[model samples]
Target: MLRTVAVPLLDPTASFELGVLCEVFGIDRTEQGVPAFDYRVCGEHPGRPVRTTSGYAVVADHGFDVLADADLIALPASTNHADHPPQLLEALRAAFDRGAWVMSVCSGAFVLGAAGLLDGRRCTTHWRLTDELAAAYPQAVVEPDVLYVEDGRVLTSAGTAAGIDAALHLVRRELGSGVAATIARRMVVPPQRDGGQRQYVETPVPRCDADTLQPVLAWAVERLHEDLGVERLAREAVLSQRTFARRFRAETGTTPHSWVTGQRVLLARRLLEDTDLSVDEVARRSGLGTAAMLRHHFAAVVGTTPVGYRRTFRQTA
Candidate 1:
């Protein structure tokens, strides 16, 4: 249902975020059985060099006209968000009004807010700027904790790697998780990940050491089907429950329960996609206990029940 993609270049673009869009949507992966987007990079002036905030410049082959035929329009972080080129904003508004999928990475959400597209939509940006986005666009519900938010065809993601998550999510939604997973594998990232900006904001990932909790995390990952409650995990880590909790908050940025639930949801998605497992079987395999419990968690975490999810992805193949 989606194919064409256009990324519009604004002045002083953040190179990494712009690069993220290009890597996700611009690359040709049809040889690998993935749908290749008709991708275009556009600027206000065709062939004019746009300077990046990182001290380099790049050029766009097309002008704003390229956006007209696009199924998706991606915005990257720009040097300026409060005031945008009128023509660019108008084009963005037209794309949104016509029901095209429009997404922004990092500070690029500011451009959507300025265009009035974010008004009354559930959106997000980098955690550091969520308050600014909310203050600037009072009509928008700015959720600061999540990696991304989808309200209709408009999507906004947080900083850096979070853009990958948001883009892969869209790909999975439109083209199925198989295609998304393929792209993710090629990119060497996960198709879907749990937790969010909350953990990162509270505590960044610490430098690894012998006493680091990564070994414990790896151990827990392999045993998601087992009882990994705090008590057991803490004892396995050879620390008091209180100390383990504190260190976990420091290292991973989320509680043990929230982290494990996310892992289970991911496993359920994998089972739904790659196995012909029934709801009860998937529930048991994913360690969620029952079909009813799996449905509740899967729907809450994945926005679809297990059966519906399986139906969507399985039918795609």
Candidate 2:
């Protein structure tokens, strides 16, 4: 029963992002078997035309009063990244004080940070503005590489499309994966993107011409129960360890060991959600060897214990 209220700040980009949220949360999807949200679009002033960066004006039907009763408040990306109006900041602070889940899309993190909601919280913004955000708000734990960061109630997305991912994540968290999947299928977008994935680049995808490592990755994924090492994969790729390490990082934006660990963690999550395996069995099957080791890596990467994750996501069969 999440009630969503979007604060459409003055600017084209922010308005468009607000429109995106509306398309996702405001639409009545009961025909598709998806639960509908109590959604509202609020502006600083009621019945006023707000200017957008997209060279148009949008008239809002409500004002900040809608936010006071909202269970969730979304701050869409703003054109002016450096400044937030005093009244808007005060309104957001009041909303947060009332225990509402607050979220931001792309540069919208700037607005949240300005309102002091993101202080000491792990958050992310568009990768292009990561440096500026970090320099401006040193207290925020800024994760530049993540597509989005869900730090309890305060969620922030990396960029435009990543906002959709973040919104779907909220849907999954609140309404369940089945509902989220239905929404995604209707929108023709992936049900989920690993939050840790790098943002999509406009540059052409690099062709893996010299890559003898395709088989190695496939083999590693299939045999995740076994201990894996760079040297072992290097042999499979027909390259020395050093050469393999360099190539792996270049292609994946991560070290080989890190990539293997991530894959194992992902496998463990799937098992936890889809099976009733004991922690020890899941750890063994995912190549972490022991329950204690699973807890350590799971806590580090997934930010939760295996048992805890299962309790949250396990589907009853």
Candidate 3:
């Protein structure tokens, strides 16, 4: 249903953010069975070159007229977060009034705030600019920690690469996980990343003897069906439980328990998407121990129940 995607550009745009939108929505992947979106780059004035933060200028082939019928309108980051064009703001308001999806990357949330779309909605931008965004739009519920937040038809993401996560989430929500996976496979990125993950780590890394935990982590992932408590993992890593805890936090930016739980949830997602296994079986195989436990953790991490997730994302022959 998300067919047409229009991007409205402002001057001094962040090229990487703009490229993220283009990569996710504009690329043609029909050969891989991913439906191509009707992507357009538009501006207030058609055919006029807009300067980018990287000292390059790009021109929009269309104007705001393209946004009138767009299923999705994405705004990319720009250095000039304040003072969006009045016409662009009006177009955004009209699009939202008609129930079209509106998304912003990084500081582009400023444009949405100016159009009154972010008021009273949970949203997020880059962590560095979260305070400024909250102060500027007091009525908006700003979540400074999330990678992205989706409220109603509006979606806002944290800086840079988080745009890919938000965009892929929308694709999966609308088109199905199969289609999203196809696109992600072609892009060589993970098919799905939970939007609730923290955008940045504020705590300093603890000192550890090891440089990385890749081998131990990889070993744990393969044995997710087995008990993966901190004590067991610490034994495998040949370290004291206290040292393993500190080193795990330093190496992975999360506790051993949290990381293992996240991996199990990911395994559960794969099983739900690629198999017709019963929810109880998925729980058992993913080391969740019981259906109730799976449901509880699945809901907490995925925002959906196992049955609901399978119904939504299950691949069919």
Q: lDDT of model 1 at residue 91?
A: 84
Candidate 3, 167-276: lDDT as tens digits: 99899999999998988888888887643433133323223356567778888888999999999999998999999899898777888887888888888888988988
* Poorest lDDT segment (10 consecutive residues) of candidate 2: 197-206
Candidate 3: deviation at residue 211, Å?
34
lDDT of 2 by residue, 1-317 (tens): 56565655654456657766876788889999987687777777778887777777788788777777787888788778865667778777887787777889889999889989889999999877888999989999998778788987898998877888898888899888999999899888888864343313222322334456666777788888876898788887889999989988877778888888888888888889899989999999999999999989987777667887777579888
Predicted candidate 1 versus true structure: per-residue lDDT over 244-304, tens digit per residue: 9998877777798988888888888778888887889988988899999998887666655
Candidate with the larger TM-score of 2 and 3? 3
Candidate 2 has what TM-score? 0.63
- List candidate 3 stretches off by more than 4 Å: 194-199, 202-317
How do all the candidates rank in terms of TM-score, highest first? 1, 3, 2
Q: Least accurate stretch of 10 residues (summed lDDT) in model 1?
A: 199-208
TM-scores for candidates 1 onward, in order = 0.65, 0.63, 0.65
Q: Please tell me which model should have the higher lDDT, number 1 or number 2.
A: 1
